[model samples]
Target: MTSTGMTGTDTTSTGTTGEPGDRTGAHTDTDVAVVGAGPTGLLLAGDLASAGLRVTLVERRPHATGNLTRAFGVHARTLELLDARGLADELVGTGTTLTRLRLFSSLVLDLSRLRSRFPYLLVTPQYEVERLLERRARAAGVEFRRGTALRALRQDAEGVTAELAPPGDGGAVTRLRARYLVGADGVRSTVRDQLGLPFPGRSVVRSLVLADVRLADPPEDVLAANGTGDAFAFVAPFGDGWYRVMGWDRRHQVPDDVPADLDEIRGIARRALGSDFGMRDARWISRFHSDERQVPAYRVGRVLLAGDAAHVHSPAGGQGMNTGLQDAANLSWKLAAVLRGDTDDPQALLDSYHAERHPVGTAVVRGSGTIIRLAMARTPLRRAARTAVARLVTTVRPVSAAVTGMLSGIAVSYPAGRGAHRLAGRRVPDLLLAEGRLYELLRAGSFVLVAPRDTHPAAPEIAAAPGGVVRAVWANPSRRGALLVRPDGYIAWARG
Candidate 1:
């Protein structure tokens, strides 16, 4: 998902583009300038524009994009994030949902018992998520300028100035300025490069082959996958007749972009899983490496990076896209607050983003790396031991529960001090409210204070204190609780 290699690029000092506004001296472009139109940037652009901020999303490519989606599984927590934005239903409708996570032939992790409206992982393409987000962004009035490569960025105490190498050959570099900027470019991010932030990690594996094909006769386990001591192979349905085939042969450690063939994938599958489930009629094939890397810092001055630009991991648990989408949700509101001058300490609010999200990104890298390495164990004895341990954990209820929660992203929570409200910094479950679900209220893109009529007299004062930015809603008198739900559907504060 890297577009940094696009050609027709030139960055000169004093070439300007875009028709300037009616009243402007230095041509301040928009309130926020977002580089890269991936899922993270799309979500952030939509949220900021919906909040009435002038936002422009810049893409290095010339068009919207095709179906070359790399990530597949949208976990329960990511579905919850999209649900809050009123887009999850459409995405979930197009994708298949699985109640259990198949780790191997013997051990399957059940997600049916998780406490979420979306209790299962939705098997959908990364582009499907992007389409829904892009639609919302267009409706919210975000200016999308494709074919514009962000060449350079400079930031001061006021705002950020962006230099873009325009579309065609010998295209002059256009200048844009905004109150804030974000780099959502994938793995080889140009924005991250300009900022000089160190992406500190090594490549985990190279030349991992990926294929989309049809199975003549479906296997008993559609997510049929295993590591055969020397290699690994996995098969997951595309919600259509096609299935995704991913495999890595430890012996064939070749370079990426060396044209991959179908026979190579077939051989790896045969060696790893005994048979390839009669796979044929390959739709497409390619190769890529898994990297376990994280940026030292997400924010540098007025610029911040999200999505693959900030962190990348082995796509072991299908967490890459979900983690990036969640990162967008986490950063959008804080950016809106700071840009609109709603927070007393804007820098502190901005700093909170890195403080809160960096650890989550780190945890994801560690977990995914561990899973991939475990699957890459070479010896026969070690493979058997892993399978045995996996079976044992699956048999233990709490162990299985913990694994499901962590993999599905529901187990994540922030650090909130111990107040009387126990739900602070916890993900608020989608409650059945009189109007709709708790997430339905979050579509307003503001903090919602939901209180039982009998329990919290201070709801009125809390809303009043925040200058009505905190919206107050009431439940039945006997419900006996109050919850201040953040825009992201996490409980900021709650009382029972």
Candidate 2:
């Protein structure tokens, strides 16, 4: 099969299909069928195919039209996930890292103080991430069907059958069968609609303008953001020659279909940010509205939803894409295990996807909503309160840590099982191993068992507890006994 790269390159796609004993009478064309070739689906499909499962990714958009600049900031935890897949360093080189995030005119958050290898948010276009993930997915043999629209979907006890509309008008429809299907489509998700799921939320802000332009005179700060009583503006570098500028004007609240002239954007930016920095020569511009919406359930029987398909929020914290990427990381391994028959109770394992991620999605929606609301505070008292809160978050140590931890995604953790170790379900920091680092050990895309160095000689056997778990030893040989790190770099289980 032919696979088209995001850079408009051509490649071949081939993958091995898994045949579980449970599929007695039902035969699937692929192990997993993924809709939407965005970052979430690409990562999930790549991980599945790397685990020796056949994955077919269907995308409604054409390959050549992949340049989307909606999301620009990649948070630290997302960089760590890419590190596990050996793509973080390369991605980092492609963009600028902003250690200081300026909000409102005076308040600043120091991202460099975050406790992680990637201490700053990387400013790059969303396509850069898609480019890397698409390469990996194609190299891992994930079949890609571009310009194919999902028409209908049905799931039986055995598998999911997806009816797809091929490229071009009035073309013949095709059907693909798979044991599981994932909808990583986007905020306007067809799969979610097909599942009859209601996206419950309200539009927080409207008449928001976005543009990528060549700034004749750039701002001194890597990132500049501020919100006046009547307008708000945010500016950041794309690392290329162009920069991303977004703003909103309360006085000019027009419909989204109205054309956003460069002059209007510059006027709003100058009013909110003090200066437009000679913004000119726009390459792309659009007016949009942001809504805080999420699906009630991420998983429904054999079909699951991810990324924007599962949740969407105001782009206040720059967590939209990062949250989706993490969602894929959290769900991909469990799906692979169930499809491969590594787990006995597949339903429980699949159900955990919704159980663990729904709360996080809720938190993201609320947190981002809070930020955007504060930024758009119009009343004098509310603006004062916003300033006070910002000051507390920047000055108070505990408050700063909490806010930064949640925003940077380093402090996010899932619920541990009953009587489990304290570290269980928490993200594991990259520790120095005898040979390399924790993330390096995860490049194989499987569970990793890390034992203290110089432990009992049977440590390797303990690591090989069942399935395909990789073994590693701590470089310093601490008092900690053993830690089973999930493929996504969370503590599955730990014994001290």
| Tens-digit lDDT string for candidate 2 (390-481) | 88888898888888889999999887655566877789888888869999888887778888765543433233322467878878754568
The candidate that wins on TM-score is: 2
Q: 47, model 1: CA deviation in Å?
A: 0.9
Report the C-alpha lDDT of model 1 over 281-362, residue by residue, as the tens digit: 9878889999999997887777888999999999898999889999999888878766665554455566667777888999
Compared to the true structure, candidate 1 yields what TM-score? 0.91
Give stretches of model 1 more than 4 Å off. Answer: 1-27, 167-169, 418-420, 454-476
Clash number for model 2? Answer: 0
Q: RMSD to native for every prediction?
A: 7.3, 7.1
The list of candidate 2 runs beyond 4 A from truth reads 1-21, 167-169, 454-466
lDDT of each candidate versus the true structure: 0.79, 0.83
Clashing pairs in 1: none
Compute the lDDT of residue 3 as modeled in candidate 2.
8
